[model samples]
Target: MTTHPLLQALLPLVDDLSRELAEDERYRRLLGTLRALIPCDATALLRLDGEQLIPLAVDGLSPDTLGRRFAIAEHPRFAALLAQRTPTRFAADSELPDPYDGLVEEHVGHLEVHDCLGCPLFIDDRPWGLLTLDSLVPGSFAQNDLDNLEAFARLAAAAVKANQRLLGLARQAEAEQQLAARFREVAGQAGRAELIGQSAAHKRLLAEIDTVAGSDLTVLIEGETGVGKELVAQAIHARSPRARKLLVSINCAALPDQLVESELFGHVRGAFTGASGERSGKFELADGGTLLLDEVGELPLAVQAKLLRVLQSGQLQRLGSDREHRVDVRILAATNRDLAEEVRAGRFRADLYHRLSVYPLVVPPLRERGRDVLLLAGHFLEQSRARLHLRGLRLGGEAQAALLAHDWPGNVRELEHLLGRAALKALARQAERPRILSLEACDLDLAGTAAAAASSVVVAAEPPSAPLNGDLRQALDAYQRQLIQAALTRNADNWAATARELGVDRANLHRLAVRLGLK
Candidate 1:
């Protein structure tokens, strides 16, 4: 029991604890001490990506759950932990909601945890992950105990960093082996696009995209707007061998008419009136990276010619430069138009189309993705509900059927807009729940929707054009007046019924109607 040389040598080890807490070796040794200090049945370290929280390490958990996500929405305790990103302790039957209820029942039944202490992990003062401890006994922690646990979190954060720096040098060999092990463990877990669908069309599209993602080939993503073509392009770039490099985007539709050429290819001094200095173009800036030409259908003809030159020769000459320069840049172009038709019509270059289409991926519209639509809808609803601080919100059975029944013409974009609108209305308590929350929840103005419904042909209702000669406010008011009048007439001027149907408050609808002089 007397002090010994080992105990004398342990002072630095104690001093070194903070930065070493998360390192594997240190974590194991400190695990029993942490549990005694905090007194818990289970404790876990969670890693986060954006709002996602996945389990990383833990005690008292079975081997199967080392790497699974516990979504914040589904776990109430965890949700509050995320919102505060600070340490908290819970007692059995506490007033606060227990968010992790279902996960516990499903994952570890009968091993009931009645108390918890949670602390967020942060790096650079920005949140990085979470540290959590749970217990099965009620009233296990007093106020001072909770305070002490938070202190432990602070110390743990320090140890995590220190050990990470030290063991990082020694981890190279171990990391490689672990990585190889995980690659096999997660073989098929890399689900397609994180956007699920089993349809033959969807499968084929996935296969083609995967085949081209490993290559340096140019890719053209073709699809309707809202079909997530850009995300697919991102997937290709991210999964490609070029993932470590940059991925830049340019919306051809958004380019300035006078500056498109100089923007795509560099500009030399005095290239034009405003060209005051030499500059590198997008292609050069994207050297060793990927350039995404979004809305390629909108590119002007002159610009298209220059673009063709770059694709054909891998060379670009600045606007006023006599010499040409070359850079290594991969092109990923996306369009929602029928480029083959454009090529036949001479609007697009056939050879350019061929080059860009070496790997063509058509993202099927959401309506065609079968069960994926419902999954997406549920996901969107949860996100919208949380963002609006509305809870227990969901699509009623009728609403769900209507959403699935309709052919989402605007695709995912329309669905997101509809869900967002319904969540807003839910915040106001206007509708019981969103039934797609009522097609009225969407961009389907009563008149336009009815008109479209009546027609066997689906006509793209040109959004009311921007007025050339009036204030934008006036244009908006005019559009509102038109929509309100149509809704009133369609519903025979019953304010409550109209308001209910349109997902707006009766008073607000009346006010809008009066403002628009629809009386």
Candidate 2:
């Protein structure tokens, strides 16, 4: 007996659903098949994550829709869908707000979906997520359509379960073989780069990290040198679904221009003069994981072009190789340089900059993070105390004032190093063994700095503002003189230390000091 064409079409879909290997491919094909079978305007599959529904695969929705996380309490439609067992269809004129309003890609300008159908999926008799179909036309779904959708929902659940089981086994095997000592070392380093601040700035940064971590978006982290951009990258990786996999980091600036391409894309044997063996690149190593490109603004133009192609297509060919390999890597690019300005100056590729900055996260400087300075100082003090074998360590009131007043040009790293130096100095000066090691303002060596003295200056004389005449050059000269003098005082006339603190060469700083009549 011959089977019907509808059954014939569906048999292949079911077979494909059972045999597909990649989870993303399976989801894409599953959604495609459902849309073909049900004739819906839009369809989405969401997975339950804690109290939120995370979009796994979406068809006919806005690109940004997949990046969104719908909280159960925030969306009444999703809440209603989860509350019921059977397929729930909302009327075209239902009063309840649609979670995906204005989110459909094709329809713009506050478009409200007229009809909606949702069915919750289950695995092993427990709730997993939901499959949703939406239409712009009124009453588009009939009873038969609902029934068909319900049946398809069952098949989708089976496909999801099978795919998850396969993933579990594959991950188990990969974990067993790939969790080497290098992974442990990287994990430990990531653990140490914690975001430790309670200020509003810090809270906002943390919130941004949490929101973007779950999605496979390319993130660009911009900040000044030593502002803890790597820590932000680490936090994103730790919070992502790929947290179990390796997070490979490469410093673009540290590598020579000649070797940057080879380091990033790897090379086969005989690719270069010293190409002794075939090797996997960072992109390959970071497959199913994340790759952090530190100081990405430093990449050569040729390498940047290649990087852009790989990012766009997820395809790369090793050096001197004809065959192309596919990799799945979520990229996180970081730099202290202003890439936008670099693009304008022709120093960086504009296309590459746009590609890398799909999601930009800026780490606030230490000076802007107000009261967080003390909290971070306390943290660093404890670390120093333990590392330096001190009995007890505490910042004195004057020391706290000095810390709050300092500009912290080098940010958290400078703060950490300063605390370490202060602790050592305090320990050395203590002739008798004191029960509590106290770090005073003098011990911090910031007495003559502009920041330290600003707190004590009379308001009328200094005013903490530019001069009324607005003589920009004169004002800058005065400010530079103050900074140089403060650095010299803090360093006890040690020009090298002063130059280091000011981030200038020793001879240059000395020349500037002499020019300003500070000799």
lDDT of 1 at 204: 79
Each prediction's whole-model lDDT (CA): 0.63, 0.77
For residues 1-519, write the lDDT of model 2, one tens digit per residue: 999655664675689765846776888888888888777678999987557787778898754355455668756889999998779999998987776655555554336688999999988888889999998878888998788777888888888888878768435434433433234465555223357665689889988997998899999998877789998987788777777777899999899998998899999999999999898899998988899999998899999999999999999988879889999999999988778867876879999999999999999989889877876776677566556655346666668788988777568887887888889899999898664577889988753333433322112222334443345444545666666666677779876567667665343355456757888
TM-score per candidate, in order? 0.54, 0.54
Residue 122, model 2: lDDT of 89
Query: In model 1, what lDDT does residue 443 have?
Result: 28
Candidate 1: clashing residue pairs, number: 12
Q: Estimate the TM-score for candidate 2.
A: 0.54
| Candidate 2 residue pairs that clash | none
lDDT for 86 (candidate 2): 77
Worst 10 residues of 2 by lDDT: 453-462
lDDT of 1 by residue, 1-519 (tens): 676543343434466564434454576554555666656566777766434675545675432234244466555777777677567767787666542321231233343456777888775676667887776667776786667656666666666656656767335434433443343243322322344444566777778876898789998898876778877876676666665566677888787878888888879989999888999988988888789999887788777888888898889898999898997899999987778866876778887889888878778887777655655665565566455544234444445566667666567777777667666654555545432222223422323442442231112223444543465445555665555555566779765556566665343355456656876
